[model samples]
Target chain A: MTAQIASSRVQRSSDMLAAPSLDSILALTAPGMECVNAVILTHMQSDIPLIPALAGHLISGGGKRMRPMLTVAGAELVGYAGEHQYKLAAAVEFIHTATLLHDDVVDGSDLRRGKAAANIIYGNPATVLVGDFLFSRAFQLMVGAQNLRVLDILATASAVIAEGEVDQLTAQRKVETTEAHYLDIIAAKTAALFAAACRVAAVVADRPAQEEQALDDYGRYLGVAFQLVDDAIDYDSEAAEMGKGKGDDFRDGKMTLPVILAYAAGDEEERQFWRDAIAGFLNSDEDLERAVTIIARHGTVAATRQRAEEYAQKAIAALSIFPPSPIRVAMEEAALFAVARRY
Target chain B: MTAQIASSRVQRSSDMLAAPSLDSILALTAPGMECVNAVILTHMQSDIPLIPALAGHLISGGGKRMRPMLTVAGAELVGYAGEHQYKLAAAVEFIHTATLLHDDVVDGSDLRRGKAAANIIYGNPATVLVGDFLFSRAFQLMVGAQNLRVLDILATASAVIAEGEVDQLTAQRKVETTEAHYLDIIAAKTAALFAAACRVAAVVADRPAQEEQALDDYGRYLGVAFQLVDDAIDYDSEAAEMGKGKGDDFRDGKMTLPVILAYAAGDEEERQFWRDAIAGFLNSDEDLERAVTIIARHGTVAATRQRAEEYAQKAIAALSIFPPSPIRVAMEEAALFAVARRY
Candidate 1:
């Protein structure tokens, strides 16, 4: 059955030149998305005005809500008809937002999602503390779901996400970071939550283990493809498209997959340039331009896109276990959209 | 029944000059505490060596483990014979440690528990991420307890604690902060966790709501007394004794009870001195001495200790409903010790 699904998905990808956009996918889950937004607004309340204010600043900043959309879409695809998915979707978004707040502080980045980061506006102490509040709120939402398995998935996912973040920190600024290590970091940091978000839909719908594992795989592959495209876009897109400045990963000395691939495939002179750039030696617009030229010359960006497309196809294949439906088609298209989107 | 307990507790406090020390209290709950220590060491484990290494550096830095001791003692006082209390105790410690790590980074402190702060040695990003990992680990531990009520209590307490920390930030350097505001902050920040820790024992043991309320009250009052004493010690104790520098609160312009009292009661000139000191104008050791002298002249430290004794007595009074046993006596003594401890 899996082999059949793989061949069918590959054939479908070749037939369909462009996947459905994020707006269309979100439109498929509009009602569920509205419920999640309501829950988010309600839970963000506190007697301490600063919490709701800062949280509002971030939540209203026009995030794509991609993770929560996956959660809602996953539930619909799995035939979950209950209201618990709304709370769980809100929970997933809360976890994601909490991490963004902390990530901004960790990276000392001034902007997030096309606005001044919360830490920049409210200061680090408020951002960190509010991040903690949102995290606790996320757990509260999970507990309200009243399903032990769902709780286990999310709680374990939270830990792995943190570890992945720490792993990324450990690997930062080191030109020697292998592609395998880079994959591990993104799998843990980004894909774990995505996997859990989808797997939880199966648990909520009381599906069998096979279905649960399939959904988890789908989300995991989709998440990897999404991050790969994000990293690639960091090199290729403008600040308006990427939400932050272009070449942010480069300036921050982040060891993304493209850099790792290019560094491994480069000549001695090229490798020296890569090493100096990652070590904080490269600083000007010209340096960034040259760096981009080198990356483009080696075709790493194209290669990176090809790798992302592979994961996107795998993600679509994972959905073959489910029968055809509007929700399932939307989820499959969402996977393709993840890799194909420029931003 | 409540009045009788309150009267008896007042009589006991006057009759006993010196309360049992923390050492004696820990010895009483030594077996349960040993179990908690084991769980802590186990949960702190990770494939990432940096995590366990940094967590160990802080965990083994000689914290009194007073919070977890309260959990064990609370369980013992309620006659809980099950082992879930050990896991809950460890969870409480994890939450506490996670907050300490974040607090150090938020405050930009160079030291914690008489050692170099985790951020100082490991860097801010690592400390923040590790703190996140520990917090996620804490939720996992709570889920292992398998009681929704226990989950509810800890989860609510975690949010309240973060809210309280933010409230403190809002109150920082504002000399006009009222005493009522300070009490609310400490009660939410410190006492909420203490209260929840003790209350979870009742939940785990399947005790009645009345008993749960009593234990929560006991922990709440004890936590307040402990924090009040800590604030007082900042103005009176040596750096080595307090595990951080002397006048650390004063230097940070923290609005503690001592500063609140002194500022409220001082003459205009003294108020001006306080206004300058708390605004970061006071810089030298001599300035701290004068600040202490001003506080002492108004007897604020002594008054603060007296207020702490009131809360300590209330903590003991709340525990009187529990049957008189070694654990009960030790818990009552622990209340007195909370206020009386010099360090």
Candidate 2:
């Protein structure tokens, strides 16, 4: 075992002592994730027919099942022996899928995951209704899990996620949004679920409070890092296409951290350009180009990446309480990948 | 007790032996409803300002709180002696209110409960997010109630409701929709919640499975009757304006029972007119007027009410297991009110 570990470390030294990939975590959790996927597929089905068709469109789309993966990985890290985490992990994924469906309608987006959004094909009415169906389906899955502590964690996370979405809506179209407010929004909308996903594993495993808190902190910081990098990549100017449509936040007049930082650091003339662009007056390709250029010149995208690294480090540190298993190594490297990935 | 019952019966005989009013049920469940209202107010709150504001706008509007009242009244009829029903009742109302907010967006309505809909005033995006918030809060409250059976019932009902909404969306503007299909839609979308709302009370009261099933039947039948009348009233020219904006079904190209019946019985020319109106080619006020005239010519509105009367009888009959009591009488009369009220 020591020889294998030494050889693996030697092999990864050229890649900063660990491979910047989710491969380790994905491999570690593959068996459990198969069960989670089965649970998700089973629960998303409905006699309505349209419900499954619409939900399957996005669920089968290339989401990577990141949230549910966190739940499974956390369960593995805690060395849980029960099968209850399968339904709970699927429930987490359902919550995430539901949010994506509603987010498409809320932003009136044309594309998601490099394809036409469910709202565009299914129409807004069906999209909204299907989102509701998936959300209700999520609760049903949680109830089937029969763990009230885990149910409460996910339920509270869901409410917080909705409030964050509403907060983002209220903050839309304003270049004056502060960094603190932006962080708050992302923390609620994204990190709350991630935290709950990890925390519930410890709850179901009957781990101590300190272990649950550590897992919660790990997932929360990783979620923030993931979202920050995502926002930065929207204007990265050199990255390939990720899952989401590029320039969506710009077109939607969303005040993400990169834009907020850029707006704060701009000259008067640059600020005027931002105010106009984010106000929806300047939304052409050329306008998007100029906005990207301004952000790049201000180096806020790089700054955003730098901030993401800090969160990723914190996420890694949150796992220090756990023993140094390969699962721990995979989880820490996954945080690095969250910061390092461009697409 | 017998003398008082005789006196009340003699007094009610002047108004047809059972009053066409909700006053009886309201009087019986007033104290319980007070607690439900308090729970609703407490739970709808959020740190985000817009959530409570948007939710409260429609919640405080005069909609009679019928779903929650069913919960409270069911508890009374079952002789429950606990406070948990209050939270469960409030949870039921939250589910209903969440759907209403989403319905406003789905239908693109200008008014709800005789006032400006939340979607109209707060914009569709905020309305959708707030609806999500309330839904999550509903489950949170249900978790606090600590009854997995009640949670399963409500969760199942919520998914059915969403499926019904999606099914309706699929059936919209298609005049070939069958009556059976329409009934299926209404039963799933509207009656499922009502059934779950009543049944949860029995579950929390720890009643026999038979009692739970009985309450479910009563609520399901009452909901169908209530919806049948609501649809009939939309096309009923003799009726005064209910809370909803009149002619909404006509304008939205919805195929309710009246329109379905009118089309089935109309002459060739009338059928063509029905198709044109339902397909959105002719949605003027004059078109709505002509549509109503044609429906009246076939007497479908009266026929629809006749159908509602049958369901109301079934609803009242579902209470046969209960012994003679004022609460039982009040519930039976409420079912009658579901049929008799013009609005």
Candidate 3:
């Protein structure tokens, strides 16, 4: 009976993925998102004008706000009716924005979300300082939530995310990086926050331990799927669709899942080609095209998509523990949408 | 009678400054220091070897650990005999170290504490991520301390410190920066944490509001005095004595109190010279020497020192509300020592 239910859900998810859109999922959390936005704008206020100015530049920029939406959606899934979820959702957004500001400086990129990166306009020092302010403000919001358990989860997630970023930094330009290593990196850098965002929803609702763990699993798998698709999009999508330039990961020599899979499956000559490419020997538009062709030849994009689909299935399975509801359906659809998006 | 006591304390502090050393203060906190060090080492552990390796490099890099010492000393002065102070002291050090890691990257600094900065060896992204890890670890420690008040104080201080750093960044190389602006920058960037570190001791000890406020004032004034002396030492001390380098503030075109005062006191031609020097027009050793000469000719170093002394006196006076004891005496001596140190 359990297997039958799981198989049916898997079939349904595949159908959902065929025409995936976040519209339904986003609509379910639209009210909570408005409250989250208000909280974000309110807490970002500072006596130092540069803080608000720099923060506003990015916050108002065209981010999908997917992480905060996940938080709100997760809260509703747990049947949480309290106001604390709004603050927690805003806190999640603040953490994401803070990391983005610092990430741009670390990457030394001049663009973010189709606009001039904050560091480019404000300078690295101001950008880094403002990032710190936002991070601290996120903590203040968590404290205001008046839940130590939530603080513990978010704080630990923050540390894990930082560790994952450092791990990725270590793995950069190294063609020897494995799929397992890539999974670990993504789990830490991306999935950890998603898991925490979902788990906090259960925390606020004072749900059973099983429910918390289930939502956490759902988010973790969904996040991994989302990042996998994002990495694949770097090689497969158009510049306009990606919201930043295409081939950014390739230009930066970042060793994402697609690159890792392609490198491992390639012949010796092809491996050397990847090595040189990542080592910056390859250049120009022709080289990028050739790199993409090589990736396609190995079927790594399809392999990467296959891996994302597996995680998406896991995300769907995790929700089976919860009873069926509109919120649950939207969340399950959101997981499918994560992997199905082209960009 | 109160006036007489204050005058006598002032006289004693002046005498103490003549032969100033932190030996007595450090000795008083020596046992607490050991526990704090242990906590720091334990919390810094990670499966990622790089996290500990980079953190250990800086943590063992021979900082005075003055901030942690202040925390331990504050707790001891409040007559708090508890284990929580050790964790709090370590948290204070972690916060300070985290800021330094990010600050080095922001400043593009090559050396810290007479060694190559972490960013030079580990890369900026690793340093930044590790700094984030340490900051989150600090919050985790605070949460373990189980005091909401302590969390509030430290979290708020973190935000203020970030704001101060941004204000300083905005003021950098601007000859028009005023003494008031300089004070505000230092107060937020440095003294806010100092005050929080001290105030948290009272919170943990469950001391009265008066004691909490008194210790906070003591830390705040001492921190201002310490930074003022540090800025003065940048122009007055030898490279060997200063650890990192002398004239770092000058080279960075930082608008310290001495620079602000000298610029304000200079004639039109001298003001243009100051402006040109700060704007990077002056680069040679002789130019630096001439800059020092002009500052001396205007007596700005002396003026800066006089201001530091005033704050140090205020720090000592703030301790009068606490009962006279060995701990109180050491704290008072520590404040005097802050301004008296040549480096």
Candidate 4:
């Protein structure tokens, strides 16, 4: 009971630092959640000297450890009080980190979260291998859970995420890339983990089937909204405003949401620029400026944000089946803030 | 029943091409095993135009698909009868391909199996992404198995393999790389999956615990033997006979098993050569030859082969626990041949 009170105090302190909606959900999470999270966080980092050097550069860069948080939070919501949540938390983080590592490699990204990308610092081989290491470790931890439902969810998500990445790779430059294709890829690659994270929480808690489906839906929509906003911010904000420093997605000729929308609205010349020059390389600062101008003209930036909002609203709607609780309320608001955040 | 007989016949035919002991186990696997092998053979080839062009050059150049073959053979030994075995066979191949992709990237090797590597042909980015794609696909197929044991084994193997690769990266030129260190790295990078493959076969069959453990032991020892032989072959075989291979480990200064063995043997001149030239770079053919002469004089090549043989023997011993079936017999022989094969 003393432990529970101490955890609550910690949660309250952390909640104060988060967004309003996040604060509420953060509060609702069980007192033991921190113990699980701490266990996961400690184990997730590599003990290998070089591995730690590279990972230190990453873990310090700071994305909201949201996926793992979801796992822990959902488990708590489902009434699970066991230590398995820690293992699940580590497992989820591993998968997430693996994807990020690969994404950097694929993009040849120089920076992530305002630091040098792993590939940039350690080279592609090390980055890729480390990513693989994280993936394998994640599985080891998940297996420790010894829950078929959790295993199935994670495995399926892992595969779908890869397929989604592949789809993005193939579809990135093509004008024929559709909304459906984008949604499909996002659902597989991004949302699947989010869905699985929440659903597994329910599995751990032994929650009712309907409640599990609701949480799964909530996570799926939340992931979609998060991605949509991510894509939107790339085009809408400048380096100074967005910590990303520069929008490389446009420069890289990626057919992100803004590009998709712009392509839909623009003329043959615009399409030709994308195909010949921008798609291949950004020739100069002028090319970037022109690309931005074209995206603005297409109303893609606003449209993308609106779509993100729709997804967030849908995420909130999914929580309707759950009985009213501070955590559920917080989840509803966090979905909105996820897209609304500056960075 | 007819399908099973047909598969057995096919296996027998393939086994006829190998050593006598391997032939018997080939006849014991279920009909679906062939289907799994087929999937592996088909998907293992890269479809990226340049990737395939390079892979075809390599595959046709005749590197044995030893890993995939081991996977299928292990499934047979365990009396696995499901269609999922075929998917697993493909999954194992994907994992193997991913490692090879990363290996080429790290080694910066132009040739593998005889032909140009994927990285050499398509560049590092393409190779890395394709490797990621294969890994994700492997995970996906494993998920379809809905077997937690299989997932756990494969996942853990993947992580260990990555760690081994990374360990090699740092320890490349260092003479301090001990036999234990070498074993640790290779066990994770190479043998873990081999063991996992056989163990998963037992898992799919829901075999007895002791039988499963035996199969896993066989795989672990077989993988160790196979890697030891491969490392030894780098020293003993002619470049031409070894398929576009060069004694590049010495030239590039990787502290492989033979080098470690020779270094530990305490030849002052050989140690100096390793420190000065092999640890740096072989400047000329003379340097390469000198290094080779030192290794030969140290009897390291013979010692390494002896170690490989010991592992193979141990692998054979592991199979004593299994029932006296033709499949089990073939499995035992295959483990021996894994070390004994010249190329």
Candidate 5:
């Protein structure tokens, strides 16, 4: 009786103290992720050496492959028995990869995943063309899945992603951008794919509409939570080393949540600093440091983290419809991990 | 009898003297084109203001809408009675427009179809993102067509097109690119979509594979012929003032047939000049004029035009399998026009 009580206490104490990790979901989908990775490798290739070379540079980089993982994990949750989910998972990844490639070009990013960005290595022309190749290949994989509804969902998501990118571009450096508009941009650019990625798993499994909707909600909220954290970390003075350059958004004048909230709460002098910085006049490292200091002063970075936690909760709640299985628990933990990760 | 003889003689003389025109094909597809244009206008729009503004800049620019016209005319040839062709046609134009937008970014071009390139006005970031938006919109439109096979064909063609583009980028400024490799490049980058555009008509019409193959052949040859003429016109000393910047390929060191043939036919000294010019060591208007002079001296521009005529002939003969109809006659004339036009 003493040993049983001590062991239970250890378990409860560990659960309480330990930060959430993706270990459960990763283990659950490891085998299927192997299959999806195989599909990605096989499909991202072309007879043109440059095509495969450029695509491989980014794909083989240490990406979490989070989008495809969601598909496979969602499949496991629904007990999908077919092989089509692998291909669909790969499709989800290609769309994400395509967007990343284009995103690097649009942002003129110098690095991705801590390596030089594809555009930096391959030049913008080849990078852009290869992105097109992968996107087209994504649709080809989707067509191979032979589910028209999945095609409709992913196609619409892709368009929305582009529109969101454009919207973000328009909002860049604009001090007047509202928080609501910021949320809409993230929902469209980032969450749409996440939702489609998870929803496609239920789709290929021929599951019920309720299960599909549940997965969609789960993925969408998780995406929003993840992006919020990403934006916050850019201004997080104590954040860990990340794959991207430090203060990238600040230098680029991206109007992320921390900046918006800080600007909203700033006094005359702080607001003047913000208006000048975001307008592209102040783009030095010192300026970035100043921006981060102001954001920390206003506690907006922590505020943004708190906001992300709310979305993470919504993501977890969306999974309640699923039964109390290990996969469901894994997914819920993954949502928590979305906002919990330092980088 | 006397009046009939005089009128017949006048008709014969005028037919012999008149240069080939797209008039017949244009008139044949006019009604269908209006519907296709309406579909294009309706679909190219987005809630994002920049998308419509940038897209309209190119779409409203005096584009001939030739690709969609081919679809509508092909439908007429096969007697396809469905309305799906219009949507498919619009989808084809979107793909083409998306490529054009990206191409301008890739080439860092200043003008397209006689006005400032989209990149020049909207900036590269917006240009790249809008291209992606249109490409996704193209896929959405294809999905709306609700034909799995059509989607497959276009998806495959789109991949091939990107592959071809990458291959061309690989081949740029390489003086060793052979005639055969050049042909392969054009076949992939330019002809694949043309072939798919025409083949889908036969597909939606539920025509036999033989007819599908015939349309594919027709379109593929015509595309080659058109590209040949376009390249030749860039070097054609007397060619009309064009919408594009003059000698763009030459300045970019693109290995078009004129360059390949000129390099092959020249002596060591002449080849050295060709090599230096193509390697970007020479890229002034004076250099362009000198290059044009050399091309004119070797008559390679005429040689390229002659080569185009041969493909145009093949394009015409491919349509011979169809029973004689006004649409068939118009398509045949369009092939002839593809070669006969100077600009």
Candidate 6:
């Protein structure tokens, strides 16, 4: 391997340390999961060279492989020693990555996971088509799971995610966006997949109805918490550490949790700053800094974190319906840790 | 309705005459097909306002609705009177329209079917997202058809189309693009959906083995024929009548069949004109006109049309397995007309 590949592997190893170590959770994974993993690796092929290049560039960017891990973890938690869960896990990851591709294009974002986005390097058209390729490939992988319920849950989730994205585009810069509206958008855009990820695992495991519902609830709450923290980090993280300019939410005119909280707090000067900066009445680094300062002053980040904590608690509570297992415990811990992690 | 809407409606009526009148097609439609149509209309909804706006624009834009018609016709051709065909038909149209939406975005096209393209009016992001929304919804609708085979076929076709599109993007502005490469791209990007559409209809209809293969062949050949004509018309059509501006293939650096033929036949001066105009070396209207003149001089358009006719004949020949019916005859005629009418 090249020096760069070696360094990347080392970096990935370090990033893995940031999460609650999954050693105990991974122990329950059977040999069948490996088979599913192999299937996933084989099926990601694209006949077009540029597509595989773009896909490789994005996949090798070294984020925590949390979503796919969750799939395997969820299945293990349900005592599923079957091969299908691994495929489902990989399918969920592909779908997640596909959404990111489109999301970057839609937001015109240049950075993701501290690397230049695929759209930035390959242009929007290639990004969009490769995203579509991944979506189709993901669906193909899911079909291999051969479970109707999993298919239904996933297909619906895919539809809602697309709808949520379109909703987010229209809702941008709209200060009147209510908590209900925010929930709807986040549910569609983020939580749907997380919920489906867990539900599909339970489904392939052939879990009973009530247990399946509980897993879904846990996944949904975890996803909402994850996204809430993510939105908060967009404003709160330092520019260098975040690998992008700070206050991206404001720069993009997105009404994320912190901005929404600050708006609801109704500090007159803060409201004025937002009205000017995010509403396009002001355009300067000063306006952006002022807006971030106002959000900080109102303790919006703290409130967002508190909201995330509530979701994490709800996720842990939902797990009570499942039988005791190391994987389950790790999932509960992961939900808490997801909110606790920093850039 | 205003004069434009009235005229558009009249034009739609006349265009229907160019094939079979819509009324005749509807009158002969089996009861099973009516079910498919109803399901298709119900599933196209999105919570986002922009999606609906884009949909209205696309639905109103007067393409022949030939793809969906083929899907419905394919189902009926194989003695299928089932409810799933309509969902499949709608699914095919959704996939086709979704591609068109993305194509306009990638091609930087301003007009499609004689009106402002969706991207031009709604902005590229909205158009792209809405296109994605339609695609996901298409799969969801196909899933509702409850045939795993149909689901798999459509999913694979969607991937092929996306891959082919990426190939086109990478190959654009390259004068060395071969006829084989051009055919491969078009077959995947355009004809794959048509093949899948017909194949799914057969699968849902539970047709005999021979009939299924025959219909699949018919759909594939017809799709290739349709696309060839579309490509040929771009080299020399009357822009006012086609609603698509002429020389679009060259202007966009799209290496379609006519350009490939022109390259094979042109002298040094003509070849240089193509090389400069199409290879991004020059991009002026004068250059565009010169390129068009050279291609016409080489009978590239005629050669392309001949290839299209051959595909149409192949498509018609594939339907020999079907018993005689007016609907079957109309479908055969439609295949021939797909090439003959446009070019």
lDDT per residue as tens, model 6, B75-165: 7677776678888888888888888988888888988887888888988888888887788878788778888888888889999999999
lDDT tens digits, residue span A100-135, model 2 = 999999999888999899999989889999999999
The weakest ten consecutive residues by lDDT in model 4 chain B span: B46-55
Candidate 2 deviant stretches above 4 angstroms: A1-19, B1-18
Higher-ranked by DockQ: 3 or 5: 5
- Show what share of the native A-B interface contacts model 2 retains: 0.85
Question: Tens digits of per-residue lDDT for model 1 on A109-224?
Answer: 88887788899999998999999999999988988888877887898899999999999998888999988888889999999999998999889899999999999999999989
Task: Summarize candidate 4's per-residue lDDT along A163-259 as a digit string, tens digits.
Answer: 6776677776576777888788788779999999888888877788998898899899999998887878877744135545466776665677877
Model 6 clashing residue pairs (backbone): B36-B86
lDDT at position A25, candidate 6: 43
Per-residue lDDT tens digits of candidate 3, residues B122-161? 8888888898899999999999888878888999999999
Query: Every model's Cα RMSD, please?
Result: 4.6, 2.2, 4.5, 5.1, 4.1, 6.7
Which DockQ-derived CAPRI band holds candidate 5?
Answer: medium
Q: TM-score per candidate, in order?
A: 0.95, 0.96, 0.94, 0.85, 0.96, 0.91
Question: For every model in order, what is the number of clashing pairs?
Answer: 0, 0, 0, 3, 0, 1
Error of 5 at B170 (Å): 1.1
Docking class of 6: medium
Candidate 5 chain B least-lDDT 10 residues: B8-17
Residue A337 displacement (Å), model 3: 0.6
List the pairs of residues colliding in candidate 1.
none
Tens-digit per-residue lDDT, A33-84, candidate 3: 9999999999999988999999999999979898888889888888887889
Question: Interface-residue RMSD per candidate?
Answer: 0.7, 0.6, 0.8, 3.2, 0.5, 1.1
Once fitted onto the true fold, the runs of candidate 3 whose alpha carbons sit more than 4 angstroms away are: A1-15, A237-240, B1-15, B237-240
Q: Which residue pairs show collisions in model 3?
A: none
Q: Give candidate 2's error at residue B254 in angstroms.
A: 1.2
The TM-scores that each candidate's chain B achieves against the reference are: 0.94, 0.96, 0.94, 0.86, 0.95, 0.89
Residue-level lDDT for A342 in candidate 3: 82
Chain A (alone) TM-scores for all candidate structures = 0.94, 0.96, 0.94, 0.88, 0.96, 0.89
